[model samples]
Structure formats: structure tokens, C-alpha cells
Target: MKIEVNMTETKSNDSETITTTQQTSGAKNDSSKGPESIYTVPLLKLIKEAQQQHGLRHGDYQRYRTYCSSRLHRLRKVLHFPQGDRKGFKKREVTLDNLKDEKFVYLPLIQAERAWAYAMQLKQESNTEPRKKFHLVARLRKAVSHTIHLEYICQSPLCDARTKLEAQAYSAWMQGTLFFELQEWKQASEKLVLSQTIYEKLASALNEDEQILYKQRVEELNPNLRYCAYNIGDSSAQQDLLNMRSKGGKSELDALIAQTREKQAASLLEVTWRGRTVPVRLEKIRVFLLAYQGLDASLGKANDCDAKLSAYETILLDCKEAIQSLKEDLAAVAKTKVDLQSSQLGSQQYLLSYLTFLRATLTIDRNLVMVDVFQKNFAAYQSGESKKVAKPQEGVKLYEAMVQLSGELQQLQGMENDKKFQNDLELLTKVFKAFRCYYMALTCQGNRQWAEALALYQRAETYINQSEGKKLGDSEFTKYSRVGQDLAHLRSLVNSGKCAAHAQNILGVEDINAAMSGLSVRSKKVYAAPDLQIWRLAVYKLILYM
Candidate 1:
């Protein structure tokens, strides 16, 4: 077998170029050259030629690196050379005699190949043992150094360009990869941009076959660049990268960006109160406002409200800590005898009270919704339908919570000066009172206590009527008035003895003559036309006896 190798080098002030030509002649059964022939053929050339012919599969970079490293190690062993440790051969041990030999020129390339493989392996394992990350970084640096040295030795114009670009691009890519793993997003983004630029330029100047090779390389770099862009909040760049084509249509980067935006929107709040923006530095107030908004948003979704309620409860805990700190600051201000009327402490107190009111309102609203859900479920279950029903006691607990929160809102200090706050508080108080009465009536009705149910219904009606006269707007007044009328009718039904009469099935008995025999003609007419409570009660007595 005979092999011929040619090297050409060109140098200009603007650019350094290299070119190489090689020919190989050997039979498939030619084994006389032995393992030493592996070094004579450049590992990169073998990989690139295989890839161009579609002999190498996609994503086989690590596999090829490993194979080449093993072949080079076997070759060194065949030649009675020392098998280096995992970190590569010691620099001092490589003699001048070795450097003078042609085969030794490939040693650095082989070392670089093994180093990159080791770095990638360490990277995968570093998540569990974070200390390994530093070692991985060191290995990548070593790989870069070996590749740079190989570039110096293989100075053919084409070979130089290829090796130089490969070394630089791989170094930038690996550095970016390391920074990304470490969560240094800004640095990762910068390095990845550099790698992408170099690959693009190199691809543009190459033949179609070479361009396809670099195109795949550039494609692999896109996702990491997009990921770094997203983490560093570069929305424009992230979008541009996501819009680029990969194996198919839009990239998963778009989905990732959408998900991140959704989470931010859910947890974020921008509050402007009394013509002033709330600064985000107040962590507790910010969190409280976020939860407040979250609760409002959750109200439209039936099944999701419970999770939002839990989040609001957690925010309240943060509020407690903030409130205590403010109280301490207020006490210090008080000892100094500062003007209490226009002081920052006064403002803090007012803000705290407002937050407390907001928290209370959200709690009341959540409990009301819970009570309604429970009622609907219970009704469904009672109609002999298969439905998931919450325990009736859960509704009772929610009702009690609503009442407690309403009371707390009413007692909050500094609300008197805020007309809008005062009006809302008064209206909510009336509404909660009505709710309490209505639930109590239901409890009494369930226990068959007609008298107690009637009394509670009347109280509820009274509360609704009172709310209408409390300067409530026309819309609120109209709504409350209608509710009051409904309650009034219900109370009358319980008070007229119709409930007892209906329970015994006496209202519409078929034997009307017998049913009304004990009643006067006038009472029979009252039974026929019972418009008022007195008439209904007279008819009920007559029917009960018959």
C-alpha cells in the first residue's frame, strides 16, 4: 500500500488559510500496516467523510470521539508507548524523539478528542455531584488547548481553517454549555452567540456538502442559545431563535416561553392606589396584592379556586410578619413624638389596615363560593343522583368564616376617612348578615324547626331591606330589594302553618268535601283562595282537622 499527502499554506494580513490533499491505496485485507495506520489517517477527516457519505448517523459526535480515542490508545500501546492516565499524557514525558515523528502529530488531536468526551460525561453526572462541574470545566479547557496545538501542526490552508474554526467554535460552545449548566445565563448567551456566528460564516464559505455539515452544527446550537436568551430575559432574541426552523416547524422554545409568561402573569400584580404606584420592594404587600389578583382570577374557574384560596392563606402569613415589623416601627415613631397626623408611620398603618381589609374581603368571598358549591352538590346528592357532595359541616365552617371576615373588615381602623372603603364595608356587612341569617334558616328548616326558620327568614329579609336604604346605588338597591321580597314570601310560608299542612299532604287531597267538612263556607273559600298569611293559616287548620 502507498499513501501520498500534500499540505499547502497561505498567509495574508487579513486571513490565514490552509489546504490539504491526500490519497490512500490499500486492499481490504491489508493488515501489514497494523494499528499505526490509524494515526496516518486524520480522525476528523475520517469522521467528516463518513458523515458526508451518510455512513455516520446524526448525534454520533461523542461516539466517534470515543472510538477515535480508543484507536489512538491502542496504536500507542502497539508501539510500546506509555498508556496515559485519564487526564492525558504528562507533558514532560513526551520526548523530543516522539515530536520529530509524523505519527506523534496526531497525539494532541486524540487527547483533545478524549478530553471533550470526558468533559461531556462529567457534565451529565455533575448535577448530582456539583463539585464535578469544576473538573468538567477544566477538562474542556484542556481540550481547547490540545486542539489549538493541533491547528499549529496541521497548517494546510483548508486544514488550518477547519481546525481553527472547530477549535474556537467548540471552545465557545463548551464554555457556553458550562455556564448554562451553572445558571450563568448572561455569559452563556454571549458565548453561544459567538459560536453561532462563527459556524454561520464558516458554513457560508463552504461547498454544498460542507455547508450541510455546518448547517446541522448550527442547528444544534440554536436551542441552547434560545434557552440562554429566555433565562436572561431577552425576549426579542428568544422569539427570533424560536421562529427559526429545526427538524420541523416551530421549536419547543416557543412553548417554553409561553409557559414562563403564564407563570409570571399568574404570580404578578401591578397595583396603583390613590394615584401612587406600589413599590415592589415591599415584599409582603406585593405578595398580598398578587394573591388578591389571583383570587379574583380564580373566581371564574370552579375547580381551581381551592388552590388559589390556599395561596391567599399563605400570603396572609407573610402579611402577619410584615404587620409586626410595621408595628415596631410605629412604636419607635411614637416615642419620638413625631407629628402623628402626616407621618410615614401613619401611612404604614393605613396601608396595613387596607391590606387587612383586602385579605378579609377575599376570605369572605372564597367562603361564600365554597358554601354555594357545597349547597349545589348537596342538592344534587339529595335528588338521588350520583354526585360528589362535600360534608354539610364544611358549608357551616365556610359560613362562619364569612361572618368572621366581615366583622374584621368592619372593625379595621382608618377606614372611616375613606368614603369608598366605608361604603363597601357597610354593604358587605349587610350582605354577610343576610347570608348568616339565610344559612341559619336553612339549618332550622333541616331540623324541622318551623318557628325558628320563620324567625331567621324574617331577620334576613329585614337585613336586605336595611341594606337598600344605606345609600346603596340604584343597581345594588334593586338587587337587594328583589332578594328581600323573596325572603319575605318564604317567611310567610313558614309562618302560615302551610309547612306543617304540606308535610301531612293535606293541601291538595282529592276528597275535598270531606277535607273541608269541619270548616265554614268562608273557610272553604279561604282554602280555595289563600292570598294572605291569615287566610292560609285558616285553611291550614281546617284541612288539618278534616
Candidate 2:
């Protein structure tokens, strides 16, 4: 038995009235009866039929979609009022003009429901077809527009206080949800906030059951709102959302809040660049966050050095893209504004360079780790003793790349003028050069080039000494003092290499002893076997010379 129920609501200044008219296939219902008495049983029966026809399995999106479409059709048939001759009217020919002329009171509400159903279906399809999802979002927006028009133009106080506001809030919330699915975070946050406000105001007018539903809706909106706020870097809004207590204790929410707080604190540390407050760049912040997260993930894959390298490379690429984006944004602003403050621009450029520096530093660290691994493996391959084996070429390439980046950073305007930046540049310069020389010395020593190895070690020692002079504090002074001791030990190695070479040649005892005396007096600490070998060779050479 099919029944059509039509409801029209009218509002006066003081009161609201709803009039229902019903048409049934079997019999005409009483005209004065409310919709609950006449339509509830039929609607429930239709829903039950739909559930039976399409199994109620959890992931059956198609079944759910069919149910929604069937329900929408039944709802349209009930609320639809005939305005013109049905003989010429086609269902597919319905337009906004036709809807207006027919004065279909529930048109917007039905359209919103239909669009919402399609949106849900699209969402369940996964992220493969973004264009289709975006099209659905546009349809949802149109539904929102219709709901807004109904709120203003519909004269029914029954519609105004309850139906109209509910439609508006739901439409806004759906729009926000669609925007979030599209990854339009800023718009999503704004729309969600609007929806939340409307729901809060509408809560007061609802009955106890409806009010409970409204509260649930508001609570459901909070996580999405917080997600959008976080992506858009609206820390205050995020914090507010985090402070909201959930009815059920959510461990995930607590963990997410704690993680966000950590990121916020870390981002805050980089907020000030070169003693000047720079405007927060969400893109840059995102890059930093991704880099840190990628590094953490890569750490877990310790057995896969190539994977770690790829991860670091990806981060470097992202950082470079972010730097380019910043430059373009700055250029666009410069073209329109005449009194452009250069300090802010300089600070932004410095920040970009600093990020690049960090990536390069990471690259250097990876290279050093590889070098250590190679050295260990090489030493293990050759019994337990170190050998003059070929060094990894990647170490040299990475060091050269780092030097190039540091040079570019130093060449930036005002880099030399900023004392802190200058110090940092100089320190990096010394460190890279020292490492390069040390590696070259090892390579030359492996190749049995005593003279070349001695020269490279001397150059490395000179860089270390220069680095020591740039120490800023007592701790740094002590740190460099240890570096100086390491340099002295490297000098002993150089002496030993020279002694080994001299032993093969005809050298006087006086010259051999003089070198040994110089090495012994430089450090009282015992040298490694290589150094001892050189000393013994020197003594042998001295005996031969004698």
C-alpha cells in the first residue's frame, strides 16, 4: 500500500502551523492527522524492504547507495506538489525554475540528502578519482546554496526554527566534509566552524532527543575541525579542539594532541630567524615536519642504507621546492608593493638557506656513516688491522656537495654581515675542509704516497687549528682542544709515514731521530701501530745509517 504525504508549514509573528495532506492508494486518510500517525509505518516498511533487498553488510556501499536512492524517491513522491499538467511534465526536466514555480517546500532538503548520499558513495570509493570527488563537492555546494535560499524564503516558522536551521547546519557541515576530502583545509576549517556555531544555536530550540542528536553531531565535527586547523597551522584553534573533552576517553586524540604540541614547540624554535620575527609560512613548516618524520621513519630501516639515502634525498628535494616557492611568493609581493621591507625578505631567504643547509648536513651525515661502515668492513676483511684501502668515492662527492652548498649560503647578501650567520658559515667551512683533507690523506696513505699524505694531513691540521680559533664559549674551547689533540695524533701518523718512506731510502740517523723526537715530544700518549711501525722503521733506518 503506497501513500503520498504532503506537508506545508506557515508561520505568523507569534505562532507556527503545519498542515498535512495525504493521498493513499487504498483509502484517503483523515486530513487533520499529523504525519507521524499516517506516514511512519509506511516509511519504516519501505526501509525494511530496502534492507532486505540489499544485504546489511558493513562495507556494502552499493547496497547503501541503492537504499538512499529509493528513500529519496519515496520522499520526493510524498512531498512533491503538482503545479502544472503532469501529462507534459517529465521528472528529468525539473529545473530550478520549475522548482520555484511549483513551490516545492521540501525540494532543497531532498536535494541535500541526494547530494549527501552521492558524496558518501564517492568517499567510500577511495582516493583514486579526485576529479569525481571534486565534482561531487560542487554538487554539495549547490545543495548548500539551496538550503540557504530555503532558510530565507520559506515562510514556515516550523521550517525556520527547526527544519531550516537544521538543513543549513547539515549542509554547511557536509560542505566542510567535502572540502576536507578534497584537501582544501582552510575552507574546510571555516565551514566546519560555521556549522558548529549554527548547531550550538539550534540546540536550544530542539527537544531532549533532538538536542542529544545535535550534541553528537557537534562532537563528530571536532576531529575534522582539529585536523583542518592543524594542517592550516591554526595552533590556537587546534589547541581549543584538543582541550575539548570527549565523552569516551580517546587515547588516539590524546596522542595526537601531544604530537602536535611537540611539532608546535619545534616550529616555534624556528619562528625567529636571525633575531627577526618572520611571518609563519605553512608550506615551510610542513616541509620541516615531513623531513623530521621521514628521518624518524628512515631510522627504523637501519638495515636498508639505500632506502635511508633515498628518504634523505626526497626530503632535500622537498626543501628545495619549498625554497623556490618562498622565492616566488616574495617576488610576487615585491612587484605590487613599493615600500617593501627588505629585512623581512632577507630573513625569509636566510630561513630557506638554513633549511637547505640542514638537508645538506644530513647528506653529509649519511656519507660519514657510509664511510664508517665501509672502513669497518674493509678493516674486518683484512684480518683485524687497518689497511690503506681505497676509500668510498661517495664520501668525497658528498663533501664536495656540502662545500658547494655552504659556499652558496655564504654568498647570500648580508650573510657576512650577520655575525651569527658568518660564524656558522665559517665553522661549517672549516669542518668540511678538515674532513675533505683527512679523507684525502687517508687515500694518499693507502696509495703509498707518503709526501702527498703528509701534505694533506698538515692541511687538515691547519683547518682544525683555524676551527679552534673560532670557538665562542668555554665548552666550545674544550671541544676544540680535543680536536687539537686528534690533530696531534694525525701529525704522528704523518711522521710515521715519512719515517717508513725514509727507511726505504738512504737517510741519516740524525734526520730519523729528529723526526721521532719531534713526534714523541708533541704528545706523551702512545700512538697506534702505524705510528709505532714508523718509529721502529726510523730506528732501523738509524741503525743502517749508523
Candidate 3:
């Protein structure tokens, strides 16, 4: 009842999925080939740059969302792919079958961006309107869907390698962000790690300037990774935060601080130092340590130096209170005649020593922060980059404070036998002394005390030499390299300053000698005895006149 037909399926570049059919009774047979993979798009680069230009560079998600909407409208209009009239809204989809040009790929990208931006915008408002949290998650879910579709489109044979890679990575990141919001730590970490790895690989293959954006994206992923790790109970998460804060990127971490503290309160139960473990039995000390962990984030949000200093002062006050409480506990324990062999007694002593070390270190940090500020001002003045007056005396005071702190750190019980700690402390002491002398020299230079300034410069050079003589491992050397570089730079400045000072002194002496010589010549002429004949002539002339 049916005619026998032989049909063959094949793909064609001209249509979505072209099918060629062959019959045994047909006069001819036809076949089609798949589309060529010639299409290339720098999808990540294009979107990242555009995002930065619009608003994400300044963290304005609403603005970026608006921009994405406009961009999508323009793209649709240019491609003549409008879904419907302005009054009658209709939906259009991008798929491998419908895509005719490489530019068609931007449709899903823009769609995803719009949804992501909306989610972030909602996130900012979710604090005031808790109901918006649901909307934010919904938007993120929509973003994830668009990214998934984009990845699907890029998997077509028409898409090139780069486009495929970018699509995959972007999809992973979107899924990761969604999972992060959903508090799925394990899934979020895996997806984010994949995204980070791809970006890092791309960065390594790029030129220096082009590598920056990708590398920055990788860095942005680090805090999220660390937070996820912390949530998943990774012990190294705290150390990661410390390292990141040391590099001065704490401002970007403000959002993580509150949640991290909340989590750490329950998670942090012990302290480790000098190959020893001690239980954190006191709630006050535990709370103090929790506050200390937020130090960088809190200070980073400060508007000015004074605000930052106030934050530190507050922490220092807490440190003092915690120490007092610990001291009282120790005193009470002593009255009970606690055995030295007991782990509790040992732990208490270790905790006390740890607290002492922490306090000293914080004091040093506070002083060093001020020193850094003063140094920046002075440097700006010397470079003619600022109109502010240089204040080397302020830096000298801070260096003196650091020197004292370093001495105290060296006197800590465990530190006395720790070779690495002692060596670092020694190096720190020498560097502080060098900086102190350098600052004093700057002050003397400002006052035109050339001799004193020169002497101080020589003294600074001595300290710098002493510090440089001691050996350091690779890691330690890397840690100290910045200060070493600064010292080397200061040496050049000292040399140039000395030369200029000598020249100024020579010019001053020549000017003084010239003035004195002119005065002496006039005085000798006025007092010379040979002027008596001229005086007699003058007297005769006066008598004639009379």
C-alpha cells in the first residue's frame, strides 16, 4: 500500500539540517556535507570590555543591565531579526538552525548579561526588601538558562574552537554563581575552579596587555574559591585570606567578611603556633580573634587615614581587654596550683604568648600603615606629583615605633629559640633602623642641615648593608624584595642629594667670599694713609672758598 523510498539524512551549510534522499528508481542521488567550522568570535574579550565600559567596572549592575537591553535591541535591529512590533511583543530564539551569521551568537550573550545584571541589581536591593531575594535567584536562574543555550549553539559544527571554549567557561561561571547563591558549596567550587582554570590557560597564551583582563578575572575568582573552600571546611582558607589581604585587595572582599566571621565563629576552635596546638577555651579571646580576621576588610572600607586608624585603635582596645581577661584567668589558674605537665596549663601559657605576639604584631602593623602613608606623601612631594609638604619627621616616629615592636617580638618566649623568627625579626630591626635614619636625613635635608643629613645618610647605608648581608631563602627574599628595592632606590636618592647639597654649599661659600672681598677693598681704600695729600688739597680748596 506504500511506495518503497530510500532516504538519506545529511547536513548542509545553507540550511539548519538539510536532508538528501535517494531512491532506487530515481534517476540520480544527492548527498550534503556539514557546515565548515570557520566562524571565530572573541566572545569573552568583547563582552568583558563592553561590560567594563558600560557599568560593571564601577559595580553598577542596574546601569549595565540597561546597557545590555539597548545593545540587544540594536543587534536585533541590525540583523533584521526583530521578533515583533513595539506594541505587540513576541519571543524569538537563536539556534544553530536559525543562525546565519557569526554576530547571531551575541543574542544569547546579551540575554544572559541582562539577566545576570538584573540579579546583581536585585542583590543590592535585597537587603532592604528581603522578598527581592526570590527575584534575584529567579533572575540568576534565567541567566544560567541563557548561558546553557549559548553553549549549545556554540557546540555546532559552524563554531570555532575559541568560541566553544569561551562558551563553556562562561556557562560554568554562570552555573557557579547560581550555585554559590544557593549555598551549594561543593558544586559552586567545582564549576568556579573549572572557569578559573580555563581563564588561566587563556591568560598564559595572551600578550601582556591582553592577558591583564583574563588574569584579573582569575583573581576575582580567588575570593569566591576561598569562601567556598571555607564553607566546605578547608583548613587553608584562612591562610588564603591573609595572603590576599597582604596584597592590598581587601576592599573587594567587604561582602565576604560578615558571612566569613559568622561561619568562623563556630568553625575556629583552636590556635596553632610554633608547631603546637592550643584550644581556644575563652569566648572573649575567640571573639577577639574573629574580629581580627576582619581587620583588612574593615579598614579597607574606611574613607580616609584617620578612619582606618580609628578602626585599628578600636581593635587594639579589644586586644587589650582580651589580654586583661586572659591574665585574670591565668592568675586564677595559678592559685589552683595547676600542674605544668597538664595540657590545659600549657595551652593557657601558649595562648598568652600567642596573644602577646598578636598584640605586638598589630601595633607594628598600625605603625607601619602610618609609615606607609607618610612615605607616600614624601615620595609624591619628591617626585613633584603632589603639592603637599613632605613630613619625614612623622615617618621617623613611626619607624621608631616599629623598631620597638620588633624588639618586643624578638623577646617572645617561643620566638627566642625560633631561628627563622629571630632572623626575620633581626632583618626587620635593621630595615626599620635604616628607614629611621633615612627619614631623619630627609628631615635634616629639609632644614638645610647638610652635614647632619649627610651623616644620617651614611648611617642608613650602614644599616641597609647589615640587613642585606644575612642570607634568605627564596620565599623570604621575595617577601623582603620590595623594601630592598626601596632601600636601593633610597641609596640613589641619597647620592644625588649629597651631590646637590655639596654644590649648594660651595655656591654659598663663593657668594659670601665675593661679598666680603668687595667690602674689604672699599674699607682699605677709605682708610689708606696715601689719601692725606688729597685731604690737604681739599682743605686748601675749602680755605679759598671761605
Candidate 4:
């Protein structure tokens, strides 16, 4: 593949015109059939990984640009390929002879990234200062030039097919983006389609983990393709965009697309929760609720309790911000003395209560997960192989926290008559109690109170049994199933503790000796010294009987 850039005079945007044409078929290599070198660079993987490591993960283009510049500097110094000294500017071009190491390919790639990031930074500011559009276009053209050279370098026989294809795809994507920004719908659509095709092909041939980045790029291109198609008078563009929006994922691109669409459809302001439609007038709150719809999917993807808890933390933080924004909006309204209708005010209040309930419920869930971690750690420590030590008291405290949070969730304004919510809370409360009793039993056993430990373990067994007998939802079933396993183990421990306590009661001498051994000699003299008068009376009575 090869790309040719043509500069022409155009009356649009008062900027220099740039046009890109690419040969997608056979990229004819003019270099002699040199050694069949095994030099290769996974261009797409490297660029995507770098973007993720830099600020591109969070869309901070300026930070990413800085990182790219520093990377190019380091690569240049290490390869002894400096462009120039401070006195004069001398441009260094990458040629076939200089491509001795794979790192040589990194030079143009990073340069392209640096230029592209600068272009994006300028694009953000171009809204206010239209003059920046000229600079943005220039940077994009520079990036395209670098990618063209990168693709040409990768076409050498030394490079592998994967390297060559990735370079071609990257060049096509850059050109498509430049055309898309220029509103050249025909050119943009063609290049984006080519890039999308290559990416899809690459993704199809890779393993699941390796395919993620390629597929992600394809998803990002979909919106641009649809927009370009719409500009080109495609009838299905709108429907295609809607379909893409509906098939959203947890990617940052998808979230941004969803947010933009939601803001554009401001009239669609209602959110349905638990079979009730609530009007969410504030745009911030509405957007938040829409994004919140994906929380379950995010949690479901998490394979462990910690990962799920972290997911909850992130969404709960977003919920906090939304609630704060709503409160500010409401305060401004109240200060202005705008008389809100009773129904509207009631609905807004209900929304507030609903958000609180959601937060509280998630907090309860997070606490429960922590309790599980604590119990597992303690159990592992008891098994005597784990180096990490967690006390039963810690587990008991976490369970106490879960119980409090569950009660608060049940008492939230919107949850007063929510039978389903109440049932879940009731069941959760029982689970919390059962775990608390189990932890307390372990604490008692640690303190050598065998009788108290046995009683507490029995209480825990009863509570767990009751919880297991109740009807459970899918999530609740998963949680209670683990609880059942823990209880089963506790039952055996409880039985052994019971036997030990019973034996202590029967052979009371050992118990007395154990208790006495713990006291000081002074304490023993005060409490255990024989009584002289009682001994004399017993002796005299014995002599008379004999």
C-alpha cells in the first residue's frame, strides 16, 4: 500500500487544501530482493498499548503529545539519529538503509502520534478560535505524511505481513480522520471503510485477548463512517447510528457516544426504575441515570468480589456527583422562588430518594463483599498456610456495617412500601446476622470460651439455614450458596467444640487445674487455701463416727 499527498488551492476555511490518495492493492517494493530478514514490529499493538499507557486512555491529547515527544527524543538519542543541534534545524528522513532495527520503525510512528495529538489538542480549541483550524489541518497533514512514510518503510521484505498490514491500516485511518474533519464525505467514507475492513480482518484472525484493540478501533470508526455516509446522502445512516448506539459496550468511546446522543435528545427525560417512570429534568442527572444502566453489565464482567466492588465504587462516585449537581439545581430554583407544581416537586424528591436508596444498597453490597474477603482471609489463616492474618473481630465489624447499611437502605423514603426491596433487605439482614454470629463464635473460641463459642456457632447455623430456605434471586443465590459452604464448615467445628466442652464438664479436674494455672501464687493462696475450722469439724465428726 502507498499513499500520495497532493496540495491544492481551495477557498474553504481559508486554509491550504490537502488531498490524500492511496494505492490499496499491491505495494510495489522497488528495493532489491534483499535478505529475507525476520525483522518485525507489531505496529497496531504497540501504538494502542502506548496510547493506553499515555493520556489517550482518558482523552487528554496534550498529555499524550508530550509523552510522544519525549519518547521520540529518547529513541533518537539511543539510535544516534538526532535531527539537528540547537543552532540550525536539519530534517532527518528515515530510509530503507537506516531500518536496521525494529526500533527504527518507532521513530515515524511516534512522530505521527505526536503530530496527531497536537492536531486533536488544536481541534478542541478550534471551536473558540477559528484560526486554529488552519494549524489543526497542518498538523494532521504532517501526521498523514509520517504515516505514509511509515507504511512505505514497512513494505520492505524485512518486515512481516502483520507489520505491513497494520501500517497500511494506520495510514488509512489517519487519512480518513483528516478527510472526516474536512467534511470530504466521499473521501472520508472510502478511507474509513478500507481501514474498518482491514481491522475487522485482523481481529477475526487473532485470539480473543488480541482482538480487543482491533475490534475497539472498528467500533470507534463506526460513528465517523455513519456521519460521513449521512453527509454523502445515505438513507440508512440514521438507522445505522441508532443501532450502534443500542449495541453499546463499556468502552470509553461508547460512553462518550451515548452521552453525546443523550444530551442531543434532551426531551427524552424520563427514567424508569422498578416499574415506575420518574421525570429526571436535570440533564446531568438524566445522563448519569442512562450510564448507570450499564452498571450491572460492568459488574457482571468482573470475575471476582474485589473487581465488582471496585466497579461499584466508580459508579457510586458518579452517583454522588449527580446527586450533588441535582441538589445545586434545586437550591437555585428554591432561591428564585419559582413555585414548582406539587407533582413535579414530588417527582424530583422521589428521584432524590431513589438515588439515595441506590447508593445505600450498593454500599451494603460493598460491605458484604468486604465481609466475604475478611472471612476468607481469616479462614485461610485458620487453615495455617496463608501468611496474611485477618482476625475474626474484623469480620464481625464488617458484618455489623452491612447490617446497618441494609437497614438504612430499607428505611429510605422511596423504599417504605417496596415489597421486593424490603424482602431483599430482610434476607440480607439475616445473612449479615449469620456471618456476624459465625465471626463472633470464632472470637469466643479464640478466647477459650468453648461453651459460648458452641452456642454462637449453633445460632449461626440456624440463621444460615433460615436464609437458605428463603426464595433467592440469582445474585442472592450466589451469595447464599457461599454462605452455605461456610456454615457447613462451621458445623463441624461447632460439633468438635461441643464435644470438648462436654468432656471438660465431665472431667472437671482438668478444667480446675487449667483455670488455677492461669492465676498468680498470691491469688491461689487467697482463693484456694483450705479453711482450718471446716477441716477440724470434718476430722472430729469422722473420729466420732469411727
TM-score per candidate, in order? 0.45, 0.42, 0.52, 0.55
lDDT of 4: 0.74
The deviation in Å at residue 159 for candidate 1 is 25
**What is the lDDT of every predicted structure here?**
0.57, 0.56, 0.77, 0.74
Query: Could you report the Cα RMSD, in angstroms, for every candidate shown?
Result: 14.1, 16.3, 15.2, 12.9
TM-score for candidate 1, please give it: 0.45
List candidate 4 stretches off by more than 4 Å. 1-115, 123-170, 179-268, 274-276, 295-307, 338-345, 366-381, 384-390, 414-427, 449-546
By how many angstroms RMSD does model 3 differ from the true structure? 15.2
Q: 442 in model 4: Cα distance from truth in Å?
A: 1.4
Candidate 3, residues 285-394, lDDT tens digits: the string is 87688888778877777777777777778679878988999999989988998574642337777788889877887887678668778878888988999999878888
Sliding window of 10 residues with minimal summed lDDT for model 4:
17-26
Put down candidate 4 lDDT per residue, 1-546, tens digits, no spaces.
222223344555422212101111112242222222445687888988898899888889999999999999999998889998989879998898766667889999999999999999998899799999999999999999999999999998668888888999999999998997787989999999999999999999889998998998897888887767766788677445534543444453454455454744476578666667788787767666755666676666677987777777866886898889878877887898767455333666678877876677667667767877876787789899798978889978888887887788778776677677678678777877887887787788778776677678778768867776565463423444555456556656656655554343333454477567768955654344347435644665567459
Please tell me which model should have the higher TM-score, number 3 or number 4: 4
Candidate 3 residue 242 C-alpha distance from true site, Å: 3.2
lDDT at 19 for candidate 4? 12
| Candidate that scores best on lDDT | 3
- Candidate 2 global TM-score: 0.42
Sort by TM-score, best first: what order? 4, 3, 1, 2
lDDT at residue 171 of model 3 (Cα atoms):
94
Q: For candidate 1, which ten residues in a row score worst on lDDT?
A: 16-25
